[model samples]
Target: MEHIPHGSPDDPNPLRRLSLEQLRRRTSIKWRAYPEDVLPLWVAEMDVPLAGPVARAVTDAVALGDTGYPAGTGYAEALASFASERWGWDTLAVERTRLVSDVMTGVVEVLKLITSPGDAVVVNCPVYQPFYLFVEHMGRRIVEAPLDERARIDPGGLEDAFRRAVRGGHRAVYLLCSPHNPTGTVHTTGELAAVAALAARHGVRVVADEIHAPVVSRSARFVPYLSVAGAESGFSLMSASKAWNLAGLKAALVTAGPAAAGDLARMPPEVGHGPSHLGVIAHTAAYRDGGDWLDALLGGLDENRSLLAALLAEHLPGVRHLPGEGTYLAWLDFRALGLGDDPAAVLLERGRVALHPGPPCGTGGAGHARLNLATSPGILTEAVRRMAAAL
Candidate 1:
């Protein structure tokens, strides 16, 4: 078998160093879901090599056949150390964190502990599509607190949603996507503090999906929801999967704020059983030793975002892209092209380019598309070229 290199952690532009041929050979949904002719810039997966530390950790575990049920507090400890060193969040205690299979699962579990079946889950629209799916799957009604024109949390919109959500005296949980997906809007500290105050006043529980916490650009700071002054009652789900490209590893930590610890304590013990042993090993290694690689990846993503902006301007002038401050996903508005509500369908059909359709992203997503910017510069150029050709 020939060994294929996935580029080094030191690469200035890690995304550019990847081999498109090798990426095409991948069996992940990002590659397999589409036919050979279609270029996939839809899924959240990045087209880069695994970080050295992460690779070694997973490889060693498999070589030693250490695959078994997950145990110990190492994952939590690693995250705590990372949070302190990276974001000055020293209050993330290991004792207050629990292991879960993945982020969405952790979210559902937390919601179960705090709210009933008919309870409402509030979300900022043009969000990660799964929020609607998972919340509804758990028998919770979803209330949209759509982001404002700039993709930032709308204070008035949120207040209105909260009022409507709890109108029947029903328990409500705000499923916040920090450093929001698609748009890549990293919420400010003041914004989060205001949200905490609002949730407190409305008698709503806050569950932050901070999976993209570590993926922020240098221009923005990621404030942990619990780090805010009035956020002591909020819950957060943190994971290294998104930042480190370890989505297949399946491990996440559900953390409770100081005041919410008692509520988290009621969760069933078996909920922790779902995380695979290897998953814990990979995620712990990522939090503990993957910093350098992550920094490099972020640098690459920064360049890619800029490249996408330039490409869109030169080729797809009618398209509007509000460059995100975090995550490698780019939310593009194609209404100027007059493609109706689903421009992605036209792009896929005519240009053989697959971008995540906007309609599924809920209200405010019409005539929009989410493009994955975690790929090589050449691929991004080609995708825009194809899109322009389609137009």
Candidate 2:
């Protein structure tokens, strides 16, 4: 797609075009060791800014000064439009959609609405750090199901975990991540179908997080949990934030199920009805007409991913390379760095690179540092170069 030029805003830092030098400079977490010379491949935000169409939309909204509270508007309808275009599922009925603050909010709300305190919620390990916290923070019990090596979903292990949870009198829901995070292994249709089927029979709800759905690898297209037979019977939490880099904008689409997404509708006729209006406007712009920009962004990420993999193979030999199946987050096994289990701390203290300390993701996460590869290829290469030097 030809670049569409959205007139620039008058900000000192209007996120526009991406440059390797600029990306390297921009994303380096400030105040970390390694001085100005070190590169930081941490942080999930993409180096590329919003697409022109998206930029124009937000600019237009700002121009028209329609930045009021997004309440009671047809936010659901807009989200449905996006779902239809991307997923080939024509979700024409927007009534089932509710705009939450963000994907985390949706996940927390779904858990809160469906399961009571002390009820066990299942989550795969080495996941987004928030997964563990979300369950515990809600006073709910957590069922840990760690992913196998290569980071793919271990179906047998998952089923076993669920069975144990059920047998223990702790039956509830699964906090599922599509295009699985950290490792980026997108779920196979067969695997997802099996998960849904199992949850359905055992009366377990599957709250699928589809925030990173847009930038999936070409070999892997993200299939929404609700698209599966048993998913809508459960619930889905989606947002345009990760796809379009509007997380700070705070817009998310949640499909709560069955009779109007089940959970959201059953709320005593007086609950679960609030969404950010700013998110609504930004989200609609992303879903309806942000396809071309998304394609370009994916193209950039694809290049960056290859660059990183090659660097790891060549320079950082012995670092376990968990294949990136979907998202741009590359789980680098730094165990070979031989800095004990906490390479993340060593990286920060000695290596001087600010990485997401791997331990927080639980169990298997110990030796793994999740490196965000959603930057320009130049930046990724330099980041790897710096990291290799540090090691």
> Which numbered prediction scores highest in TM-score against the true structure?
1
- Residues 1-391, candidate 2: write the lDDT tens digits: 1122321333212223555344445433332333554455666776666667778877898889987776664556766766777777674356776667788877877777777887888888888888888778999877878888767778777877787667667657888888788888888777788898888777777888878888687766777767766555667777788888886677776786663365676544323335556667778877877887787677767766777778988989978886676777888888776877778777666555667678888878877788887655555666676678778
Off by over 4 Å in 1: 1-12
Candidate 1 residue-wise lDDT, 21-132, digit = tens: 8788899999999998888999999998888899999999999999989889999999999999999999998999999999999998999999999999999998899998
Candidate 1, overall lDDT?
0.92
Q: Report the poorest 10 consecutive residues by lDDT, candidate 2.
A: 6-15
User: Weakest 10 consecutive residues, lDDT, candidate 1?
Assistant: 1-10
Q: How does candidate 2 score on lDDT?
A: 0.72
The prediction achieving the highest lDDT against the true structure is 1
Q: What is the lDDT of residue 215 in candidate 1?
A: 96
